[model samples]
Target chain A: SQQGEEDPQALSIQEGENATMNCSYKTSINNLQWYRQNSGRGLVHLILIRSNEREKHSGRLRVTLDTSKKSSSLLITASRAADTASYFCAVGTSYGKLTFGQGTILTVHP
Target chain B: GAGVSQSPSNKVTEKGKDVELRCDPISGHTALYWYRQSLGQGLEFLIYFQGNSAPDKSGLPSDRFSAERTGGSVSTLTIQRTQQEDSAVYLCASSQGFGGAEKLFFGSGTQLSVL
Candidate 1:
């Protein structure tokens, strides 16, 4: 069973627009992380929001965690063509391993 | 410092043959992980190691799949009698420590195809 599941399998937007993706999980998590993957490549770590943190930000990426709902959201501000990629959310447990979601594909038009 | 590195960027093998994939983690990292991603799909957890000890082998699919880390640095994943369904990209990652919310460094991954 997958611990995390992202909504909206794909998203497309124009340049300068903001893109948002949501992830929901089943069990308790120590942290939730977002990752970006270019086509046929390894994933790049984006932002990690700890269980105790309600929100966090890095550059244009903002993450919010809602432990009460077991959900998280990733918002990319000013989307760019370079931001076109697959975004995945992973849940990290106290045990130290992470379980990833199916991912949401985001395409930013140049 | 170099990031995690994986070997044989690409591999194509016969269905009945055995294949080996190797990973060299960043120096000083204590945790290593393996994952598989199929075309148009998300990553599936395979195995994880914490300084040569795997407290979790539950992610491994079957007896035909196995992995080992040596000297707490390099690790290898082996698949025996591969099947066509085994075709996918194998990714490796490493982190500075175990557990919590530390960011992980990843390798480009090996594209494996079992014909």
Candidate 2:
């Protein structure tokens, strides 16, 4: 079953611009994680924010979680053409299970 | 393994036939997961295994689908009497342990096409 739902199904932006994507899920979670998939290949783990954490950052990525609203957002600073890919948000559950979202396709034009 | 690995990057089978996909997760990772992704659709959870615990198979769509993880490492996903709807990419992932909120390392996945 899918719990997370990413908003802005698709986004197109130019290089150097900051791209932001959002995700919403139903029900409680232990943590929320973000991944990147290039073309149709495997997903690369980007970042993870625990339920207690309001925000976290790694490299050019920033993730914010709000348990009250059941929503999370991912921001990419200085978007690059190489960053063109589909971003997914997953809600972590017990026993190593994770419910994923439909994902947001970000296209960074060089 | 350095990373999660999947076999037969691509497989095409006819309807009514059975197909098996394999995944070799990173060593020492006790958490394994299988997910299906249809074209232009979000990942659909299939099953998950945590260490020595019994697997969680609640997300399986039908009886035709089943999976097994041997030796707490290599995992296999089998589909019986395949259908066109089963055509999708099967992804495998593994984490350090169960319920750690740890990151998942994903395999390239097997592109299964049922004709």
Best by lDDT: 2
Task: Give a tens-digit lDDT track for model 1, residues A8-39.
Answer: 89999999999999999989898999999998
- DockQ for the candidates, in order: 0.77, 0.70
What ranges in model 1 sit over 4 Å off? none
- lDDT, candidate 2, equals 0.92
True contacts kept of 1: 0.69
For residues B18-107, what per-residue lDDT tens digits would candidate 2 score against the true structure? 999999999999999999999878889899899889999988999999999999999999999999999999999999866437999999
Off by over 4 Å in 2: none
| DockQ measured for candidate 1 | 0.77
Worst 10 residues of 2 chain B by lDDT: B95-104
Q: Global lDDT of each model?
A: 0.91, 0.92
